[model samples]
Target: MTVPDSLADADGLATFAVATVLGFEDFGADAVVEAVRKSLPELADEYGEQVFAQLSSALRGAEGDGASPWSRRTRWPSLEDRVQRMERVEYAQLCRVRDALTLLVEASPALALARRAGVENSDVRHIEAVRALNRRTDEYLRRAEAVSRYPAERAWKGFTGLLLHVCSSPGRLSTFQQDVTVLDPALNDVPGLGRRVLARCMAASDGEA
Candidate 1:
């Protein structure tokens, strides 16, 4: 399954963020917002003022009984909305947005945590560990994408089990602890990369999370 490109600069990023936040069942708006900001810094750098302003405005609107993206009666912007927004952006801006989106999607939280722990990709142990995590993550994502053709219940069970395995794998956790003082370096600073991956999965499966 092919993932659609993020092409509308801050507008596109903001839309994706809204969709993602809702996709997670709006787990915690504050937490989700911070994670979205941290994970996609390029959006901030490029259009920090407007992007954040839009995000703030959206949040303010989501308060109390106000309809939010998560509300069934108030669905998030559609593909057409995104396309229209993208069409309004300059070509250069769109290019930058595309690049930023690519980085955001490619970033791996496990790798980020490893970097924070000072584990260089140069070391064989570090390389292997990183490769292992990446390979496993990719495998699951690919399977998730392909399994869309299957019935909903079967697909959900398969993805659920896959997520549980990935989240609880002792060997994977142990590798992350190797040569690192912090057991989980990203706990304080960065958002869980796994959360981002799951968010993408949720989006692909139409908010299944």
Candidate 2:
């Protein structure tokens, strides 16, 4: 469904931003369904009955017998299946980014020297951006771990807090892309080294290293 223009307000915008970051793949369908339900009354009050009716109709069409609208769009039929898929995707992405960052960190000393020597390049800025993203990700992971012990409602609040912390910065996402595009090929010419680094990252992620 088309997002209504009425969502331009602060609260609406924040909700849209979170939903955009969460996407259909990254988070569970239950969260999206819950968000939609929670926002409906507020949206109706802020906008008008016509807008609310349109949104409600759209959502009704999208939803099914206790199934998320997001689930209907994808092959995964159950919340468990979707959660497993998200975990695998998140793990792989984390490993790749970690491996790339490791390489950047190893080269940081030389990059520093180059900066002192009046040698400037995009690598420095890219590295800085990626580093910021990495720091934020690490913080989010820590928060997630702490909240895992909390009850479901509190846990969800913690999750959304982490999401806001990570997704609120558009530059963080862009810089990560810049670093990956420019530095990911640094080890490509040396297949063995590339494999070794990636293997190390995977092992570390699996708690085997």
Candidate 3:
């Protein structure tokens, strides 16, 4: 399908690329395109065109199929190389957020156990560790949000919220684990873009943990 005239600019084109990726994952392309068109004005208002361009370029590198000009892979040896060339600061911020999320996910089981045990004196060290990790995650998230001009802020908030919920409530850990498993492909596909997109979609649907 041809891109609409309204969506022909940098911001519009980036939104279109996001819709295209989401379409490939779930809804049909036509539906996604239409939905994005309807939301174009709001999205444009919410984020800067440059941020959208960076996100679109990241998505393109992630797909690596050359399906369209927007998604054509470069000769760079790695995705990180391509991202550094495009926007080094943004890439670094995203990497920090990604690493923080990964650490939180890895420590989830121990966190849950600590929460379940009621944080006795013997568990003080474990609780302190969890608090430190939580603080680090928050710091990274804030850094990412400061640099992002789009939904990354909301996505990270939702992700952190889910992580807190899972760690605090042992009963929900299994469901959280399952959801993360389902999102594993996306998480692995792109350093930060995939996680941001998936988390934003989930948050929009009120699917918290």
Q: What TM-score would you give candidate 1 relative to the actual structure?
A: 0.24
TM-score of each: 0.24, 0.24, 0.22
Q: How accurate is candidate 1 locally (lDDT)?
A: 0.42
**Please, what are the lDDT tens digits per residue for candidate 1 over residues 12-80?**
455556756455335444544555564454344333345655665565456544456344332344557
Tens-digit lDDT track of model 3 for 67-98: 54334422222545433433533445345444
Ranking by TM-score: 2, 1, 3
Name the lDDT value of residue 119 in candidate 3: 32
Off by over 4 Å in 2: 1-89, 119-175, 183-209
| lDDT of model number 3 | 0.41
Between prediction 1 and prediction 2, which has the larger lDDT?
2
Candidate 3, pairs of clashing residues: none
Identify the superior model by lDDT, candidate 1 or candidate 3. 1
